[model samples]
Target: MINYDLYIDGKWMASTGSSRIEVEDPATRQVIGSVPRGTKEDVDKAVAAAKKAFPEWSRTSAKERGRILRKVGDLMEQRKTDFARVISLELGMPIRHVEKWHLKSSIREAVYFAHMAENFEYEYEAEGGWVRREPFGVIAGLTPWNYPMEQITMKLFPAIAAGNCVVLKPSQATPLCACMLANIFEDAGLPPGVFNIVTGAGGEVGNCLALHRDVDMLTFTGSTSAGKEVGALALSTVKKITLELGGKSPLIVLPDADFRAAAEEAVYSVFMNTGQTCCAYTRMLVPRKNKEEIESFLAEEAGRYKVGAPSDPDSDIGPLISKRAFERVKGYIEKGIEEGARMLVGEVPGEIKKGYYVKPVIFTDVTNDMTIAREEIFGPVLSVISYDTVEEAVEIANDTPYGLDSAVYGPAEEAYEVGCRIRAGGVHINGADAHITCPFGGYKESGLGREGGTFGFEEYLEVKSVFGK
Candidate 1:
């Protein structure tokens, strides 16, 4: 079993408080590890460390910072197997999926940001003078459990690459990966206090970070309600906030699109990670005339994803992060039925008694006004709503409060036109893959700022114009 202490000032030390939070393996329902339950005192120490390190780290040469971050990325690559195993156990993701999606994706993001640090335009000419983008100093990164490492890295790497020091509060549910990252940075020889981690319940450490006087910026990734709380607190302190919140993202398939391909992509998009992703295409808009044909394709594709133990490399789907998540998803499934949406694919498996597994569920004949279609369920649940015309599909896609990510499949020209009309941060066209080079985040309530690539690097920076220069 893994045991962790608080990481402050680049040192692993015991928490000021005696409380500890036990980490559980959702698949086995067993205590796998524990981390210190950090208090306000811990947050103070961490923030103090970051505040101390910020001046020097922020002024450090971009090439030097790039070199160090690249080393961290290389070390992470060496420990990829360890990261994959630990995350699979902690988050109950299939080992292979963790390797591909979490470990590798995070490593790539780190490397991408590292390169951006050296190559990006830190200073550019303006109409009257020179405009410089400088670090915002001490940043507090509040990340969630679903994509623990990726979420942390998405915030941490870019912020650091832009020359900001950070205090990270990873989700209490999946803190192991964050602890491992602390070790990785130390091994890569990052300066003391440049990076720190405090693990505990959000009410304690997270809220403290949000309201801390020393914090200059706050970047959060989680539910919209939780984000609102964080944003409100951060706003009180006037700290710059970048939030990547929840999404009930939509995927549209035009009449001229490859029906079978779109259906398969829709299933893969929503069911990846058991549908816990914030930007998942949980709402699928298809043609009304091809309803049965689309349902058949979805069912066939989803059947291939076997729900089993996460340790099995071949397991296509794993348990939810915890019993709470399982129950939450089940409640949504029952709500779908109550709202008159027909279950077209799978049901909540009543036979699973051990693990917190929910069968990949697809609800057809779903109206845009239904709960299944309106709410962000954050489960392996898909709501397929039929639309008669392209304009109707666009309208249905934009009907939700969320505007995070969307997908379109059809003839290149038509899909591009449809994608332009959708109000989202990122839009994928014709089965395109997600690249680390692109900016990621949301529009509307889905989030507040952009992440990834140059946009992410800029998020941690504050612009100043030299008027007299």
Candidate 2:
């Protein structure tokens, strides 16, 4: 079992490691590792260190910072296998999926930010004076467990590349891989205090970092409710905040669309990561005339995502993150049944007694007003809601409090047109292949700011106009 201490400044110590939190493998319900339970004091020390390192680190030229960021990405790419193994072991993502999606995507994000850091427009002449974009000094990054490597790097790489120091608080359930990443940056010769890791419950460590006076900005990814609390705490000090929160995103299939392809892709979108994804397209909208056909297609595709231990290479899906998540998802399934939504396949018990596995569930006869259709059930449960017209489909799609992402399936012209009407940060035409070149975020309660590409790199900066300098 791996035991990790708090990473503060350039050192790893047990000063605030008096308590410990066990990391478990959801597939086997086994204890894989443990990390220090950081306290408010630990967060303070981390913030102080980041604050101390900010001036000098931010003063470094963008080219130098870009070089260091690129080195970090290179090291990550070299050791990606190691990262994939640890993350899969802890989070129950299939090894193959972790390797294919998590590792490569994170490496690309880092490298993308590396190039943007140097080539980004930091200063440009204006009518009266020149506008300068400066680093926010110190950043507090609070990340979730679903996409461990990507979430951490998305916040860390851009913040650091923009010359801001960071204090990261990763989900305690999946800290080993994050701990390994901090070591990777250290190995890349990141300056002391420029990057720090404190592992603990978000209520304590996360709240402390957000409310810290020295911390200049907060970037968070998690549930919408938790985001509200984080935003409120940071706003107390009027600190800069970027939040990527929850979603009940929709996938609309027009009457003329290929029913099989739409249903299959919708299954992948909701079932990927066992539906723990924040922007999962859980609500699938289809034409009322073809409801039966779509339901049949969904059932067939649902059987394809076999759930098993994370170590199995052929496994397409794994267990939920923990027993709590398993129960939560299971409860959502039961609620769907209670609300009169018909289940085409799967059950509330959801099979598999050993692991926290939740079998894929496809709900039909679902109305827009049903509880299952409205709430964000972070599980492999897809709610199929039928619409009479494309206009009503667009209306139903945008009815949610979230506008994170959506997918439209139809002919090129109609699909793109429907996508245009859908209110989301991103709208995939016919597939759900992850794209990094575009900005990713939400319109309303889904999130406050965008992440990905140049937009993400700019989130760490603060603009100032040098008057006639």
Best by lDDT: 1
Candidates' TM-scores? 0.98, 0.98
lDDT of 1 by residue, 1-469 (tens): 9999999998899999999999989899899999999999999999999999988998899999999899999999999999999999999999978878898888887788889999988888889899999999999999999998998998999899999999999999999999999999999889999999999999779999999989999999999999999899999999999999989899999998998999888998889898999999999999999888888998889888888899887898899998888888999999999989999888865744778999899999999999989999989999999999999999999998999999999999999999999999989999898887888989999999898877878999999999764
User: Could you tell me how far off, in angstroms, the CA of residue 177 lies in candidate 1 after the best superposition?
Assistant: 0.8
Alpha-carbon RMSD of each model: 1.1, 1.3
Instruction: Give the C-alpha lDDT of model 2.
Output: 0.90
- Candidate 1 has a TM-score of 0.98
lDDT of each: 0.91, 0.90
Off by over 4 Å in 1: none
